[model samples]
Target: MSSGRIQQALLAWYGDNARDLPWRRSRDPYRVWLSEVMLQQTRVETVLPYYERWLERLPTVAALAAADEETVLRLWQGLGYYRRARNLHRAARAIVEERGGRWPASAAEWRQLPGVGRYTAGAIASITRGEPAAVVDGNVKRVLARLFLIDEPVDDAATLRRLWLLAESLVPAAAPGDFNQALMELGARICRPRRPRCDLCPLRPDCRGRRAGVAESLPRRRRRRPIPHRQEVAALVVRGGRYLLGRRPPGLLGGLWEFPGGPVAEGESPPQALARALVERLGIEVDVGPRLAAVDHAYSHLKVTVALYRCRLTGGELRPAYHTAARWLRRRQLGDLPLPRVTRKLARHLAA
Candidate 1:
């Protein structure tokens, strides 16, 4: 099939059916970049509120750059994959300080920013700058896989490279941004992962997968290993109506506040593990009491069930061995600090 014909059909469909997203109304690089980052591994409905809240608080790149880390993390409290928010802050600072607040002009230059990969760079460049760059996001990949009936796993590096090349070849010089968005929109709305609405798809006639009666299963992936489950514990050490919270050191869930504790070892009971973890992680002794809450949370790579137990700080110096800082705050005051979902669940249990 000719690239021109396919592009024409997709663009026409997009013009009629594109969702009225906030970012689509403007060609501003900052807005485009922010939307692309937030939309990664997140659905549009889920990102809508967060995206609006972010702009309302930190409207400009310069504003975000000037904001403190705590404020940024606080704004991004419930949005997981906090690394994206941190990288956005870093990239904003770099753009303001190093580039004199000028946005990158081309996809190549945009790739230099922190947290920006090929897909993001291509999106921002093509959408805002009218550059003929191609984006191969999950949506685009699905569309492409079905359009050409690609049998290979989309996650493979070799397959990804081929998809990129195919995208590059098809992206039209005229309104490349609309073309890219149209292709992605097609996958999202019509060529869905399951039970696609092929009857309404503009590319229905040309879709090789549909012709071969396998459109829904064209974008196959390799079998993934089972997600490991972990058991952990947290100490709710309360004194004078105040609870102890620890600021995590730089790493996974870094800079976020949590009830002090760690993973439960294989042979250790929950209370014993909590006591040992407090001594090892916080350099303080706690008399583990009755359980307060059990938080079952799942991250991308692992699932964890954290048992929260009431504890009394018994002895030892109040030194932060693993945390950057430790503070005591009332249950109500917990709202002031950024917390992971698991920590928030524990706090809610306390409040209840």
Candidate 2:
């Protein structure tokens, strides 16, 4: 079968077996946009609950546009890669103010929206508008690389460009949304990253890699270098019953709450790092004690091993330098506060 026949077979298979994801219930641009943002670097199972809650809170783009940053951040508490939340908020506001509260229709127009990259624009445009744009996310990348026997790693810009061209060529006409979703579904379920279900795939007969018995090796990845590691000391400052938590400022994991902490310099003890960080961020003297809970958080770029300390706030009022504001809340009130999962995981130990 030709590549076009392969796509047609896959599309037919998808029409019968495509997952009934919550995001597919409606073609509303806002709902689809929200799911796409939340689903980036996140699993569908995890994004589902968050998506439902987010929609319940800010059902409309204008509502999200009008909501306070704190409320938005709180709603986005456990979802990491927080720039997605900020970008969504910024995009919502942009649509409200500039586009008269309606999202743009074309991929070119959607690309101008905050945080909407080419892939995201393509996803939104194709899903919502039936545009002939294909999205080459990780799943689709695996599917394409394995299907066409491409040896280039997905992360290489040149390889990715070629993959996109191939994707554009294969995307079926008239139902780009279904086709893109089917490709992604195939990748997520049958064409998995670790183990593919070639026996069950409709395109198995036509797959070049499968014919060569190299399906697993076609999308060869460069050997992964160990993720760079950094250590940090966090001061878990508590006053009365409440503990001090800072709202991370906009940029990366912006808007999420975190314990006061930063990079631990060379030869610096955890206590020393804790004290220096408190002074720099809050202008307060804190007595760092024994370790409370240590967590290793992995980001796309690097990894951080954080050692948290229970600190006594000796002096100085709140003068948050790198955060929007600081707050102290009871252990139970912590539930109401949206916090980083790593920080929230630490809270149980701190509350002990």
Steric clashes per prediction: 0, 1
- Ten consecutive residues with minimal summed lDDT in candidate 2? 343-352
* Candidate 1 TM-score versus the reference: 0.97
Per-residue CA lDDT of model 2 for 83-196, tens digit only, reads 788888888988999878877979999999878888888999999999998798888888888888888777888999999998898887778988899999998899887678
Model 1 segments more than 4 A misplaced: none
Top candidate, metric lDDT = 1
Give lDDT tens digits, candidate 1, residues 1-352: 9998999998989889999999999998999999999988889988999999999999999999999999999988888888888999999999999999998989999999988999999999999999999999999899999999998999999999999999999999999999999988888889999999999999988999999999998799989999999999999898898989999987789899999999988988999999998998889987888998898999888999999999988899888989989999987889999999889877788764
Error of 1 at 190 (Å): 0.6
Question: Considering only N, C-alpha and C atoms within 3 Å, which residue pairs clash in candidate 1?
Answer: none
TM-scores, all candidates, are 0.97, 0.94
Whole-model Cα lDDT per candidate? Answer: 0.92, 0.84
Task: Report the Cα lDDT for residue 79, model 2.
Answer: 78
Q: Give me the runs in candidate 2 sitting further than 4 Å from their true place.
A: none
